[model samples]
Target: MKKIAIGFGVLTGFLAFTAVAFAQTYTPLAPLPIGEGGTTPDTYTLSSYLVGAIKLLVAAGGAIAVLMLIIRGTQYVAAGINPSAKSDAKERIMGALIGLTLVLTSYLILNSIDPRLVEFNLTLPPVGQSPAAAATPVAPTPSAPAPVLNNGGTNPSAQPVAPAAAAPVTITSPTTAVTPLQNIINARINRSNDYSVISNCMGNTTYDLCVKTDLNGDGQTNLSDIVLFTQKGNLFDVNQNRVIELANTTAAASCFFKMPGANVHAMLPRENWNQSWSDGGSSAWYISGYSCGGSGGITGMPTVACSGATWIKAPALMNKCAITNGYMNMPFGFVYGGGSQFSKFQNWVTSSSVGSAVDLRTLFKATFFRPIASGDGIPQDEYFETDDGKLTYATIAEYDLNNDGTADFNASGADMTAFSACQGGSASGACARADFNQDGTIDARDLNLVKLMRNDVFGGSGFTPLGWILNWFESAFFDPAGYSDTQIISYCIGHAAFERCGYADVNGDHKIDNADLTAFNTGAPLLDFNSDGKVDLR
Candidate 1:
C-alpha cells in the first residue's frame, strides 16, 4: 500500500513538471545544423537512441529515488516508539535523500548546458548530396547571348558612334580587302618582307634607286606620294608571272613619276589570278592579256578616235572627270552628279555641235551597250538614236562587281521605269542608269542601296559594300569608256565639298533633291529613314 502511494505521488510530480515546462514561453529553437562535426546519419541515429536511453534511465532513476525517499520518511514516522527501528528508518531516509539529490543535480546540469542536448534530433542530408554541400544555398548559373558572325551582314562589335564619313578606302580582291593608303604607309614604315621593288632607276629622288619618284609631282616627299602613285600610274607584272598583284608603294611612288619608261612599282605577292590587281590601277593592256604600254601584240597602244580627238582606252582614264573630259569639258557651270546625269550628258553631247563632231561609237564602249560579239547573247551594240535621228553610242563594261562572273545586267527586258526616272534635262538617252543592281530593273533594293550609300557618305552606319559602289559607277556619267575604280577614290576626296561623294546626289548638283527623288517614288513608299521627316535632306 505504501509503495503504490509513493508511485502515485511520483507520477503526480512528473505531470506537474511537464505542465510547468509547457506553460513557460521560450524562443523557437533555430533549425538543427546538420553538417557540423562530420556527423553522418548512422552516427546521429546511434547517438539519438543512446541519448534517449540515457534520459529515460535518468528520469526513471529520479522517480525511483523520490519513491524511495517517500517510503523511508513513512517508515521513520511509523517507528516513533522503537529506537532501533527509528534509527534504521533515519539511515534509509538519508540514503534516499542523497540518491534523489544526485539525480536532480545531474538533470539540472544537463538542462543548464542546453535543453536540446538531451533531445532526439537525427536529420540526414538530402539524398545524393553531402551534408556540407546541402548546408549552402546554390545559385543558378547564367547563360550568355550568341555571337554575331562576320558575314558582312552584321557587325556586333561596331561602335555606337559611327565612323566619320570618308571616301571608299578598300581595294578588294575576291576574298579580302586592303586599304591602299594604309597599306602603303604600313609597308614603308614597317619595311615588311611581304613586298619587293618592281621598278628600275631613271633618276634618284626621295626613293633610293628610282628617278622622278615624286608621285604627285609635289616637291615635298610626303605620304601623298603613296596616294598619287596609284592615282597617276597603273600596276603591271614585273616578274612576268602573268599573275599581277598590288605594286609596292615605295617603288611605285618613286617610279610612277617617269611613266612608260620607268615602269617600276612595288610588287605584293599573290598566288593566283583571282588575287591579282583588277581595280583601276591595272593597265587595259594587262587586263586584255597583252603587254603594258601596248607592246606584245597590240601596236602603238590602240587609241579610240573621238572625232579628231584621240583618247586613251578605258584603263587610262583615272576618274569620271578624266573620262568625260575627253568628250567635252563639262558645261562651264556643270557640277558633280549621279546616274541621272546619263541622259543629261547624252542630251548635251548629242545636241551640242561640238559633241556632235566626236564619234559617239568611240566614246561609249561598255558591254552592256555593246555585248561581246561572240558569247554575249546580244551581239548588236546598244545605241540611243537622238531626236534628230543621230545614232549616239552607249555601253557599260560587263562588271561582275561581286566577283561573280555572271553578269547581273540583263538587257533584253531592262527596267523602263528605272529608265524613265533618269529623264529630266533630255529625252530618254539611256533608261537603265537608275538600275543600281543591273538586274535590269529598279526596285526597293536599288532605292535602299542609294539611301545606304548616301547615308554612309554622311557619316552614318550605312556600310554600303564596295561592290555596290562600283555598280553605281557604271550607271552614272554614262561614258562606258573610262575606268571608275581608282578614279572614284580621288573623285570622292576632291568632290566632298560639293556633296557629290555619295551615290544619292543624283544630278551631281551637290545636293540630294528632285533628281534623287525619282527612285523614292518608284522603289518604295516615302520613308523618313532617320525620322527627321521633311526637314531631313539626307
Candidate 2:
C-alpha cells in the first residue's frame, strides 16, 4: 500500500502537471497540486483586524457614555445645590449606572470568542437539486426522470436533468437566490473554493463553481451558481472497462461518468463504495495500499471517515483521480460505499410560490433507505458566519443532539430560529414591546392604532383603556429620546403605577433602598467598571 500511494502520487502529480500545462481558465474553486499553490489566505490582517475590533468596542462604549452624561447632567441642573441637589446627584449616578448597564449588556450578548467552537459532521447534499429551469429544458425535450445513478456513494447534490439541446448560461448568486438550492449550493461552493478568481467553467472540478448576486435584484451576495466541471478525475471507468455500466456505479466510474446536467432518481452513501475510491477513479491513478485495518486506515484512499472543516460538491469528487480536498464541516468522517451513491436523489425547488401549495421536495429519501440522521445527527458545535460585509459575525452555537460525543448543530428545526430575531436586537430593542422595528419607542407610528395607557394618568376615568393612555402620551409629550429604557425606569421612581419598591435592590446585596443608592454611588466593577459617565466590563 505504501508503494502504491507513492506511485499513485507521482502519477497523479504528473497528470496534474500535464493538465496545468494547458492555459485554461479556472473558477474560484480550482484545485491546485497537493504540494503546490493552494494556501490559507494571508489577507486577514492579524493586527488590523484586531485594531478594527477594538475601534468598534470604543465607539459603542463612547456613545453609551455620552448618553449617560447627558442624563446625569440634566437631573443635577433640575435640582438646586442644597440637600435636593445631593439627592438629585444620587439619581444622576443611578442613571449613569443604568446607561452603563445597557452598554455592557449589549456587549456581552454580542461577543463571540471563537468560531469553530462547534462540531460539524460529514454531510452530503442530497441528489435533489433545483429542477430544470422552464426557460431551458434539459435534453432535446423533457426526458423521463433519470434512474438512480450508480456512482459509488449517493450524493444529494445535483438532481438529474437534461438542459435543452442548447441551454443558455443562466445562473444564481450565493447571497441572492431565485431558488433555495441556489442559495445553499452557492454558499457552500464559495466557501469551499480556495482560489482567487471565480469563473464558471466545465472540466476543472476544483474551481468549477461560481457565486453571483444581484441577478435582476438589488446587488447582494445572496445567490449561487454551481460549476459542473473544469478539471479531470481518474475514476471514470472503475472496473477498467471502457463501457461505463450499472454494476460499476459504486466504483470510481460513477464519479467519472456520472451524467452532467441531469436529475438522478437514486442515492449512494459513501459507506457502500467498498473502499474502491481510494484507487483514484483509476487504479492507475489510485494509491495502491496504506495501513488500513479494522479502523479503515488506507494510505492512498481518502480517509473515508475523516471529517473536513470545509464542504465540497460531489461533482467535485468526480474531478479528482481519487483525492478529496474539502469536507462537510463536521466532526465525524461520514462514509459512503458503492451502494451509497448520492446521485440517486432528485431535487425540486420552487420560486414565486410559498406554503404547502408549493412543495420543494427531495426524492432521494423515497428511493433509498438512507439512515438520514435520526434527530439532528449532524454534530453542531458552533460556527460563525459574518454578515454586514463581514464586519460583524453572527455567533451561532450548535448543540450536538446525538451524544456520540460529536457536538455540532447541523440540523435545523423551528426552535433553532427561536432566538434568531434576538441575534441582532439589543435588550433596548423594539422587540418584546410595540416597538417591532427596534428603533426604540413604542408609538402610534409603529402601529397605526397604538394606544398606551399610562395607568398614572388614568386616575379615576372609570376604566382607562391601555392604548388610550399610550396614544395621549405620544400626541402630548412623546419624544424619541425620552423612550430610553433607562429614562423610563427613572421616571417610574415617582410614579405610582410602575413600582420598583423592592426592585431597587439593583446590587443584589439583599438590601432594599439606601443600599441600592450606595451601590450605585460606588459604581461596582460589574455595572460601572470603567465608569466614564457609563460603564463597561461587566
Candidate 3:
C-alpha cells in the first residue's frame, strides 16, 4: 500500500509538470532587418539567465559540500584509528568535489557552444507577492507604420513562416521628385569639359555666365534681358541646370525660362505648364499643340484689345497705360506688364513664326482673364470696344478671348453698339477731334473742347465742326501689312505732330467743318496710317 501511494504521488507530479510545459507558448521572434542595436536585447537576456542558473548550481554544491564535511568529521570521530577507513572517507569527499567541478565545467562548455541556450531564464517570483508586482506584464509595442519597401514591392525581412497560410505583404515609402534644371546648369557652366563659349553673353555677375549689358551696364535687369541671358539669345533651350542667384535687381525663387514652343517644352523636366495675366495683359507665354486649338486655328494669334472709339475725326487714339508693364501673380498662370508702352502690348508666347519643335501643349491647354469690377461680372478679358459715347471699337473679331473654345470677343453684329457707352469719353490724350470744322482753326471754341477732353471732367458730344482745330492735311490712318501695334505707334507720334496752332484753317471752307476736316484728313498724295494723310518716312 505504501509503494502504490508513492508511485501515485510521483505520477501526479510528473503529469503536472508535463501539463505546465505543454501550456507555455514559445513564439519565435525574428531578428530586425538592417536596423540599429539588433542583437543586444537577445544577448543581454541570455547572459542573465545563464548567470542565475550557474549561481543556483554553485549554492547547491556548497550546501552538499558542507553536509559531506559534517558527515566525514562525525565518521572520523567515531572511527578507532583506522587509517584505511580514513582514506576511504577522504576519497568520497574528493570524489564529490570532483563531480561538482565536472558539472560546472560541463555547463560552461555547453554555454560556450550555444550562448543562446543560456537565455532559457527562470524568472523569480516578485518580492511583494502582489498580483501586479508578481507578473508585471510587458505589453508588446505596436510595430511602426510599415515602411514602404524599396525592393520592387518586396520586403527583405518579413518572410512568411507558413507559405500556404499567409500571403506576402509589401510596404513602401513615397518617392521624392527630381530637379533636372540644376543638372543642366552644372553641365552648361562646365565649359572646359563641354561646349565652347556662351553665345552673345559677356560674363557672369553672380547669376548668369553670359549676358548683354545696357550702356549704364547696370544689367538693365528686365524680363527681356533675363530671357536673352538664359537662352543665350537662342530662344530654343530655357531649362536652367544652373542656379540664377537672388540679387537686388532680380530676386525670384525660380525663373525657369524654357521656350514653350516645340521640343524645348517637351524635353524639359516639369510635366505641367504654367501661366498668368492681368487687366489688359497676360503672362501665358504662347504654347503650341494645346488641345484648345487644332490646325488652321489662330492658336498663336496676338491678344486683341478694345480700342474704345473710332476717332474718324482723328485716328491717333490708342491704349498706352492701360496695359500692365510689370508682372503679377495670377492663380492660373502669370501676368507681366507695367512698363512696356502704350498700345504696345503683345502675348509673350514663343514666336511660332520662328517655327519650333517643342511641345507646349500643356501650357496652351487654357487661358483666363480676371474679372473687371466695373463690368458687373463681365470678365474684363475679352475684346473691348470703345464705349460708343467714346467712339471706340474692336479691331479683331471675337473668337476665343477666354481661349476655352468659347466666343468671348464677338465683334460680328456689335459694330457701333459697343461704342455708344463712351462716345465722348476718348481716354486717348491724342488730339483726334479738333479737326471738326472743315478748316484750320484753333479758335477759343476748339481750345475749350480739347481742354474739356483732357480733364475728362464733363462734356457734350454735339460739336458739329464749327468749334475744333484742323489738321495740316486730310483724314486718319490704318494698319500696314506687316507692322505691329508697337511699330505703328513708334513711327507715328515721333514726326507726325503738327504745330500747336489749334485752328490753321489752311483750306478755308469757312465753317471749321468738313473743309477743315479735309485739311486734317488730306494725305501727302499717297497717305497711309496717320490721319494727316501723309506718306513721309524720311
In candidate 3, position 302 carries an lDDT of 25
* Candidate rank order under lDDT: 1, 3, 2
Clash count for candidate 1 is 13
How much is the lDDT of residue 468 in candidate 3?
18
Question: Positional deviation of 243 in candidate 1, in angstroms?
Answer: 99
Could you tell me the TM-score of candidate 1? 0.17
Against the true structure, whose lDDT is highest?
1
All candidates' TM-scores? 0.17, 0.15, 0.16
Off by over 4 Å in 3: 1-55, 70-80, 121-538
Query: Which candidate do you rate higher for lDDT, 2 or 3?
Result: 3
Q: Candidate 1 residues 290-403, lDDT tens each?
A: 222322221221223321113222122211222222322122122344332334333433332221132222333221122335342322223222311111112221121221
**How would you encode candidate 3's per-residue C-alpha lDDT over 399-434 as one tens digit per residue?**
112222221111231212232232444422322222
Error of 1 at 157 (Å): 40
Question: Which regions in candidate 1 have their CA more than 4 angstroms from the true location?
Answer: 1-60, 80-84, 126-130, 140-538
Output the lDDT of residue 505, model 1. 40
